[model samples]
Target: MQTASFVGFIRTLFYILAFYYIFKFLAKLFLPFLLKKVVQKAETKFQQQQQYRPDNSWNKTTTEQEVFYKPPTSQNRSSTKKVGDYVDYEEID
Candidate 1:
């Protein structure tokens, strides 16, 4: 049968804390370098994909059609300026 002792308990606690701090320190030191390598790899992959992509000019077609707009000509322009009292009336109901 195994018996619990105060010394063993303290030793186990110290090991746990030591391991935790060591892991934290190592991660803090290496995480940024790992992330930078990952970003550079992704950028290189994206650039390679862009290089091999098909040209968009082949998918575009120029149409021979054209659109034109012209204002309508009115034969009597002076008659449109005449205003009467009916044009300014307001109803309150």
Candidate 2:
């Protein structure tokens, strides 16, 4: 049977606490700088998108007119004459 030593247990607990505080300190130091960079990048991308988008005011006036199509007039031909070209053939017996 193995028993855990009190000194080893206390050392592990102290190590865990030290790591926790170190992580908190690093996060506090670096997190805002990283967040500011991310926010600035997002803002620049949004501004670029806004700059490239077409203005809606020009489109608003043009959308009211509906287009009507007028097809070209064609000459009327007899249906029988236009059906198909005649071809001569013989039935095989």
Candidate 3:
């Protein structure tokens, strides 16, 4: 079996660092283009949805609905019951 050497270790480290930098550089170049496309697609989808949505103005009628409310009668009024006693507390410094 071959043994680990300093040269091999240095070569592996160099490869890893090179790959990392290359990937980072490529991402920086392409990420914005990808993000812009995604945003444009989303915007188009939103506009399409807005266009397809039914207009609320056409569905609304000019007729006014009258609402009537009657006050509670004395027979329907509930009696109040005492539930608990209140205790007053003084703060001590």
User: Which portions of model 3 show Cα errors greater than 4 Å?
Assistant: 55-93
For model 2, what is the alpha-carbon lDDT of residue 16?
100
Best by TM-score: 3
* Residue 20 local lDDT, model 2: 100
Task: Give the per-residue lDDT of model 2 (tens digit) for 1-93.
Answer: 989999999999999999999999999999999999999999999989877888846455665778899998898876675768799999999
lDDT of 1 at 3: 100
Regions of candidate 1 where Cα sits further than 4 Å from its true position? 55-93
- TM-score pick, better of 1 and 3: 3
lDDT of each: 0.89, 0.91, 0.92
- Compute each candidate's TM-score over C-alphas: 0.55, 0.53, 0.55
TM for candidate 1 is: 0.55
Give the clashing pairs for model 2.
none
Q: Taking the candidates one at a time, how many backbone clashes does each contain?
A: 0, 0, 0
lDDT of 3: 0.92
Write candidate 3's Cα lDDT for 8-54 as tens digits: 99999999999999999999999999999999999999989877888
Q: Which ten residues in a row have the lowest lDDT in candidate 3?
A: 53-62
